[model samples]
Target: MANNNVSAICSCCSEMDGIFSRLLILTSSITRRLIEFFEDILLRDVNRLLRDSEINSYGQSQTSATYASSSRDCNSDTSIAFLDRNASDLDDHHSLTNSGLEIVNRNYHRGVRFIFKGLMLPLYCFEFAWGSVIASWRCSCYHMRCMQANMQSFVSRIVKTLHGSSDDIGWLQSAPGMAPVEDGSARFVELLQGIRNGLHKLPDSFVYLLIPGLFSNLGPLYFVSTKRFFSKMGLACHIAKIHSEASVEQNAWELKQYIEELYWGSGKRVMLLGHSKGGVDAAAALSIYSEELRDKVAGLALVQSPYGGTPIASDILREGQVADKETRRIMEFLICKLIKGDIRALEDLTYEKRKEFVGAHKLPENIPIISFHSEASVAPGVIATLSHIAHAELPWLPQFPGEDRENDDFALAARKVPVVFPVSAAMALSALHLQLRYGEKSDGLVTCRDAEVPGSIVVKPERKLDHSWMVYSSWKKDPEDSSEVDACEMCEALLTMLVELGEERSN
Candidate 1:
């Protein structure tokens, strides 16, 4: 009977070992597959741009020659002036096209990083589990604590590496011929770079933080993708790279600690900025931090943040879509690897709870809070123009139309027509929802009305700057119309506001 029991125990142990080995193999294969997929997507997109550039070179030469010939009939002085102006305009157009292509390339690279990170999720989990198992086996409290600390350091390194790689990807994807625009045409890029430079100069005054929204880890990538534009404008920005799956309170606490370190007990004001769920984090931190710490805040900028809540989040939660085992696993994997924190997972929290976390939180009345949003519009004419240009056919174009012609009034008007089927459908639904719901002003993801805060100065430029482009600037069409501004100009506006506010306070 003892011999039989020993044999049975051995068999059970063998079965368990086999299962563990199989899981490891499966995990390895999945990670490899995801990496390959990401690489393929990035390579294909980059290759396409190289091909388009060749095609565009031929077309630009032809256009330039035509413009030169067309101006021959005018008076010599007038013709000279016309030729210079025409050349400048062409240069601007080329620059804009190149910028757009750079953005496309950046997106592809970012997707690759996101997928690669997603694959790392299972490994991260396994590492955590294996460490826990070893600590349990040894039954050493000190060893367990050391292992936990090691795990924290390891995770921090992973997050930092991911953020750095993501930023490098953006810088690598920037167009080779694209020069920093010194003129007004490059205002937005210049402004963003200026902000970055300004922040770097006053490192003591800035505390870089991350605010994440629901979905995946795309938020950081989204920021990284636009980093070039911002860098060009002068903003030396960095992401905290905290995963979206992290609890809001935890994220807030971590950011607060980081801010404290940066401030070093000095009363220097720090700028807090976030996109989507990150915005929620900024608000939460401001709300919960000690009053003395709150006084250290100089400004809060939120990009496409839904302080109220996003309808998409409500839909995902209501449908129990996030509850599927496979879906949750996939999201967890991605969140661990690609994203910083999980905002949607907080779906368990009541709307009131979320509101209390984000909305009820108030900064000092003196602290500047600036909010920005994108209005969806479709301009067929601009689309047609972009379609004709071989190099400007960006992957994100169809979804984000008004971006290319952000400074053109006519383009803005054209966008109001609803060109794409999805946008048209969304527009129709939005109209009905607005009528039924009464005064609801959302652009599908966020409401325009809710995007605003009381006493906060809102700058709604006439151009239909999409959610992403609000931070970056596009070329303006009409030279005379100064109303439509880009990111660089926006930076100047912000500075002007600050100067004016400072003067008022002194008075």
Candidate 2:
């Protein structure tokens, strides 16, 4: 009986160990799949944009040489000018997107290797270590706690070094026909102070640029969270409130002048770090500004900027479709009231309007840029409770009685019968809109491809990180190894770019 009991206990231990091993493999596999999905989405979007540009170029070449070659005539004709403008826009768009894609691919392979070699295997070891502790209660908890403490200390050391004070933050400063960094630190400080002072009496047309995505407008919140992350690195830093009712261009111009007045006026070159739409604005500014102003820009760090535009936006603007009353109301609230009233009014502008502003600009090839992006995933059990609440509060459709419904024209058009039931239609439209709004791979608003710029240093954080949280700068008391890795990567990239810019000036 004693032998049999011992045998049963040993058998149970073996089963648990096997199960643990399988769980670790499953988790690693899921992570790998998520990364791959992001890569595919980004690659496909880029390839499509390239194909479209090529086709458009080919089509234009087939047109009469007289129309194409007559530069003065082309400038005069609005239609020709429109075509020419779009072509140029498309060309630049293609270049930036392709460049961003290359960066994404390079980092993606690195991320894959990091996950497999650095994270997964280590995680497995951790699991085994924990499992051994679980098998015996005698001093096991104490041992586990010690191990955890050691890991925490290791992580803290790395984080502190990478995100340390920016007191020595260095970049090349350029004046007209000259570039130098002798007074880089002093100049940056003076520039920051001037900008802050200028913001006190901001012009009505002057708008602080708002980048779209989560945490974009959470000002103080973002500062507290991210201040330490980049503070010690001597990078340029400023905090400004975006104005209500200002156009995107107006906002861009305001930021442009602010940087110009602060950095360029003082003979200091500048670097702009824009997240999401802010990135678009930075690129747009670079395109339209004078060569002198452009020359002053050392680099642009775009964190998940969608330069190619978003498919979700395309879905929202689908032609000939009338939005349901509820949908329209939500749109009005989000666009007119929230964005226009409180935030900048750019979000309310039509895609074509936004495109028009962006269409007029092109980034100079000489400037180096780094882009960071995050992958989107729909977790199986995760529910977007906010969206659900928004849906629940919407008014029911009147035309279709005995049913709770939201009636968009698209939903109405797809009906098999003359009178679609309200409840069924609402549920259908709700599901469709939810999928369009929250479904698929997106960091809320921007797709992975749209989030990153081509040829920029692209860092896709661990899965489950939302678009807004990618730039989160909160300090961790007991930071994980992965977190330290992320901070180090960002610091290394930023430092390398600054070094390169400095070198460029020396030459």
TM accuracy, model 1 = 0.42
- Score every model by TM-score: 0.42, 0.42
lDDT tens digits, residue span 1-507, model 2: 544554565667667768978888898889788877876786687668767877776566546444655555635577566667766776786688678767866776787667656656777788879677656743544465567667766666555433321221111111132121121333323333443343221111111222333224533333222333334334444443444245556656766776677574455566566666666666666766747566676677666666555544434443333342445556557766665542234342334444454445555767766555555444433333222110111123344544323345544333322221122223234334334643534555555544444445455555444444444422222444432333323423443444455457558
Ten consecutive residues with minimal summed lDDT in candidate 1?
386-395
Candidate 1 local accuracy as lDDT? 0.52
lDDT of 1 by residue, 1-507 (tens): 544554565566557656876787898888788777867776787768776885787587668767776768666777677667777866787777778778877887787678677868878798679656654644554455566667766666555433321221112114243222111223333444555445322232344443444443532233433344335445444455555566667767776776676567544455666666666666667667857565566666666666555543443333223333454566556665555545444552323345455444554566666555555444444333322100111233354454656466554454442122123344435434532443444444555544554445444444454344443234223556545444544544443343334446557
* Model 2 spans with C-alpha error above 4 angstroms: 1-215, 233-236, 264-266, 317-319, 324-329, 338-358, 381-440, 454-464, 474-480, 483-507
Candidate 2 residue 131 C-alpha distance from true site, Å: 95
Full-model lDDT, candidate 2: 0.49
Model 2 clash number:
20
